[model samples]
Target: MNRHISPDGYRVDGPAGQDDETGADLPAIVGRNLRRLRTRQGHSLDRLAKLSGVSRAMLGQIETGKSAPTISLLWKVATALGVPFASLLTVEKQAGTVVLRRDRSKVLASSEGRFTSRALFPFDSERQVEFYELRVAPFHREDAHAHAPGTRENLIVAKGAIEILVGQHAPVELTEGDAILFEADVPHGYRNSSHGEAVLYLVMTYVETVG
Candidate 1:
């Protein structure tokens, strides 16, 4: 699929002429969720923009499905809305046992496709913890802003080598089979300086369950 750059300078995955696993347009899902949450909280575009540090025009575009959002932008909006990051991407939950097929997993990529995060668990419910599979292109560094207070990330490198930098702390290097856990309320980043791509599994836990 071709990537469409949003006005905010983030790359958005274009529609592939087919529905996602939820049988709904991805952008529309985000837009509907965003609008619902915003209105439910009695927030206007101007108000949300101030709370999220995003532009009012951009917020309007996203809410109207005229533009797709980046992971970082979504995080900011979700934080402002006091909800889980996955809440914006949530779809109808299936009853009984569920299996998330790899082919249909929801993937969000960074600008230039240098970084990608695939949700490993269903986004059907609001939970305190969420799981994801992260990939970093060789020699690429993906930085992330601070998350909500009391949030933490437990990550394990599945392949290749990488460095994790959190706030003012020293960079922690890890190779295959290595793991680390850190507070995520400070700015952090992942650097894959090795020749091969880096793969990691992350489990993000918040202090309390959020919608």
Candidate 2:
């Protein structure tokens, strides 16, 4: 294995800065799930690589949380494992499509404080829709992140402000109560321009199931 170290703020062992019972543990939870699925299918690292066309080294890295897999790679693994790509993602359950209370949410924060995510669905939900509350502190910016082929990210501003930059489109600014929905295939990033903190809600979908 390459034995790559966890990025400064990111946790390679699991979701960073989250505890076992606090819902902050998505990375770990997801990692375990992947391991379980792999074991259940009687596939080894080499077998997964041959089946998914992903390198065994890469699979080891993903399974160990030493790296973040690109959306395409994730899909390949999911396909080989015979599971929905969304099944590998971590999300908390919501009461409905309207709101997600803080108390019932799981917060995923990077150790470096770059970003924080609160799940809107149970971490193990099989639903097609996934909701996340994202917080980007001042001076914190995100690299382009994308999901499965048909995924869409609905960004709604609940507090503070942020600039949503998607692929080649001009950046869009969202403030409190403002929201934007777009295809998540192309690269995207979030920038917090406020002097203090900025928060937003991101609802990601594997298909166009939610309008």
Candidate 3:
């Protein structure tokens, strides 16, 4: 299979040449959502670039479906647009019971692919809480920027050992079955301390729904 690395350094991997479950191109979906939201808020590319700290060229590329955005970049744009992170990924809602199969999960990885996050909930509607599965390569660390105000995260270590660092607070270590809850409005990071990959589950709750 051929793989292409995004400008932000993460690679996109999925069934070759296949669309996502929504039967639409993933990049196109993101692009449409971005363009719609940006125009809706009466913000031009230059204005969005200033607010998001992302270059206008890159923003234009994303809006035109010419480039796939990285997780960090998406977060920056979402924050700037005052919308939920999932808002950029959402498609038409599917009614009734929904089952998210593992093979079909939407996964986002870090630049080096040492860290990954898989969304466990459908991205069809605005939600106050979101669930995700996270994996960190052995001895790898993933740093995340601050989220919107009033955000909170509850995470539990599922396998192996790792350390959680939240802002200036001392690092908190966790083993299998250990969990921690903390405000997520500040910078935070995860460090895997074991020789084997570490697995974790995260529940992120927002203070209010946006977009």
Give the clashing pairs for model 2.
Answer: 15-27, 91-121, 92-120, 92-121, 92-122, 93-121, 93-122
Q: Looking at candidate 2, what is the lDDT of residue 207?
A: 59
What are the per-residue Cα lDDT tens digits for candidate 2 across 1-211?
1111334444222332433332544444456667777897799989989988889887887777665654446657765775655566644554555443555444445636578776665544556677777879986778554554677789888888889888899989888899999987678888887887888887877753321
**RMSD after CA superposition, every candidate:** 2.1, 6.5, 1.8
Model 1 per-residue lDDT tens digits across residues 18-65: 655556666788898999989989999999999999999988888888
Order by lDDT, highest first: 3, 1, 2
Candidate models: Cα lDDT each: 0.84, 0.66, 0.86
Off by over 4 Å in 3: 1-4, 16-19
Highest TM-score: give the candidate number. 3
> What TM-score does candidate 2 get on C-alpha atoms?
0.65
Candidate 2 stretches with Cα past 4 Å from truth are 1-5, 12-32, 35-55, 61-86, 89-105, 208-211
For all predicted structures, in order, the TM-scores are 0.90, 0.65, 0.93
State which candidate, 2 or 3, has the greater TM-score: 3
Best by lDDT: 3
